[model samples]
Target: MATLEIDLFTARSDNFGVLLHDPETGRTASIDAPEQAPILAALERRGWTLTDIFTTHHHQDHVEANMALKDRFGVTIVGPGSEADRIPGIDTSVGDGDSFDFAGHRVEVIETPGHTAGHICFYLPEDKLLFSADTLFALGCGRLFERPAEVMWPSLLKLRALPADTTVYFGHEYTLSNARFAVTIDPDNAALTARAQAIETLRAKGRPTAPTLLADEIATNPFLRADDPAIRAHLGMEAAEDWQVFAEIRARKDRF
Candidate 1:
């Protein structure tokens, strides 16, 4: 049998909320809740209803619509173990290595604590799709708001270790801005130049540049390329520690 079908819907200005459907069982799971209208509109268009919600963290933009959606559709809300107390209407609380079945597809939970103490990413191994919340963006990463740079480093490294082919669906739509920052880090990276041009073309056509593949991000996104010798040398770093490189890239972004 073929892998399940996944559809990505960009909600609000920069958020790309995802809908994963299992045809075998006719079930659907939404990755995040940035707003209710987009999800409602998408589901109405597809003639499908939401059954489950997988939250990555407790951010308002991500979780604010949870209750409204659950009340409207009676969907089960699943979130990380660390934030169960804070997440409203959580039906199931999970942690790293936890696996659950929905619509005959196995979804594994990965603990990625950095952006938030309880941030988690959903991994569908069969499909090689990772629903990276704020932990990993297309060309940029979430601001180290709740945690220090030290905590976010390991979390990012874990996501980077996933197979290069893994398709990443991040939480926001910051690719264009991120690509602008990428050029400063690796001015000589041909991939970054090409990616910026492609992104600009898409934006000009009013299209979204999202659902970036991990391999492509590795090629252009400096955050995921912490271990690359070229990036390390550019930052004047010695060790290939993911956090060390992460710190340098993040510091530069803050000023950029």
Candidate 2:
């Protein structure tokens, strides 16, 4: 009955480093290696040895410590197959709809390409945990760097379809800024206003705002509410498609 042990810690200026350990099988994986020192220190403190690195994308900030930790522990590196050529030292290439086992738990790979053309998310249904990387954030989605809002909206739907109880761990600590922007677009939402106020307190206390519950994000995150009538009215896109609303929101955020 032992469950997965997740070690969440801060690394670099805004990155979060997550280590997943299975007590039953003694397997450990770093969701994405943001920095070498922090990953190693977290493992050292937990007394867990690294056996795998499940990479979410080709971004340097996410994969910077891949080789360093791999060389240190000889851990296997798993990454997106579509970006295999770009990912450094990828030993396993997995794609969208592909899944694999991690210490008896099923790891579902979802291709979310707006943040990066090959950015992926790892969802563990049994544990209700999602390593969202840079795809979906607390109150905002990742900037449309590699794809347009049309493509990103569908990618987000893949996550929004997940169980409400799922606990999400994202790549960066961008919640406070995201919250600031969210209140502007979803001003009429009581849930969002309250959540934004709480984010202010959380950041003031220097607490991490990540590992947010999917249910909370669904209720308050404007990015996930493009189909909601209130937000559509706010943007004067009452009859527009969901992605169009999403595009307007993204553009506003970029300018904000």
Candidate 3:
């Protein structure tokens, strides 16, 4: 079987709203709505009406445009059940272990409550694609906002356990900035150097460094390498908890 066609829309500057389509069944759904104009324009360009909107969290950047777009397109809004109260206009509330169909594709909702108490990432096992909100980023993870570092660590581990082939579509285009910080701590990481160079090249051309594969991330991303001996040693801490490393990395990024 071939992978389902996933079209990415770079809406609201750095935020990305994805479109999942299955030509066989002619079904299409969008992942999130950070802004209204760009998502509407993308849908119009493809002549596709928004059938469903899956929100990862209640962050304004992720769900602010939900009502405007829903009213404009008559779309079904789905969001994390744990955060239904915060996610405005959610018609269907989902939780961990829940599954839904989109264009003949089955998507599993993975509860990742670190970026937010209700943050949930949609995972398509068949396609090995994870619409990881702000929980897991290219070179870093989202800041510990409403939750503590310990609470966020397990959430990110859930994502790291997925198949390495999963294509991670994150919420922001903060790669270059994050990579710069990663190199400072893991200066000997040849992969990080290479990826930084590539990212620099891509950004210089005004290109997007998105839809990055999880496999590449595992090899190069420091946030996902808390267990690595090299990283543990560099942190000047032994027997450190996963969240400790996560905290260190996030703290560094904040200062960087």
Q: Best by TM-score, which number?
A: 2
Error of 3 at 169 (Å): 0.9
The 10 consecutive residues of candidate 2 with the worst lDDT sum are 1-10
Arrange candidates by TM-score, descending. 2, 3, 1
How does each model score on TM-score? Answer: 0.94, 0.98, 0.95
> Could you tell me the lDDT of residue 193 within candidate 3?
92
**Model 2 score (lDDT):** 0.94
In the order shown, the candidates' Cα RMSDs to the true structure are: 1.6, 0.8, 1.4
lDDT for residue 233 in candidate 3, whole number 0-100: 85
- Which residue runs does candidate 2 get wrong by more than 4 Å? none
The lDDT for every candidate, in the order shown, is 0.85, 0.94, 0.84
> lDDT per residue, candidate 1, 1-256, as tens digits?
4467677788876788888877766678889888999998888877777888999999888887899999998999999989998887899999999999766567899898878889999998878889998989888888887787778878877787889999888898888888889988887899889998899889789887778899988788888777778878888885757677888899889888
Q: On a 0 to 1 TM-score scale, where does candidate 1 land against the true structure?
A: 0.94
Which candidate number maximizes lDDT?
A: 2
**Following a full C-alpha superposition, what root-mean-square deviation does model 1 have from the true structure?**
1.6
What is the lDDT for 122 in model 2?
Answer: 97
Candidate 2 TM-score over all chains jointly: 0.98
Candidate 1 Cα lDDT to native: 0.85
lDDT of 3 by residue, 1-256 (tens): 4356777778776887788767666566788889988877877787777778989999999998889978877888889998999987899999999998877678999998877888999999988889997988888788878888788888888888899989899888898898888888788889999999899888899888888999888888888887778887888856887778878877887789
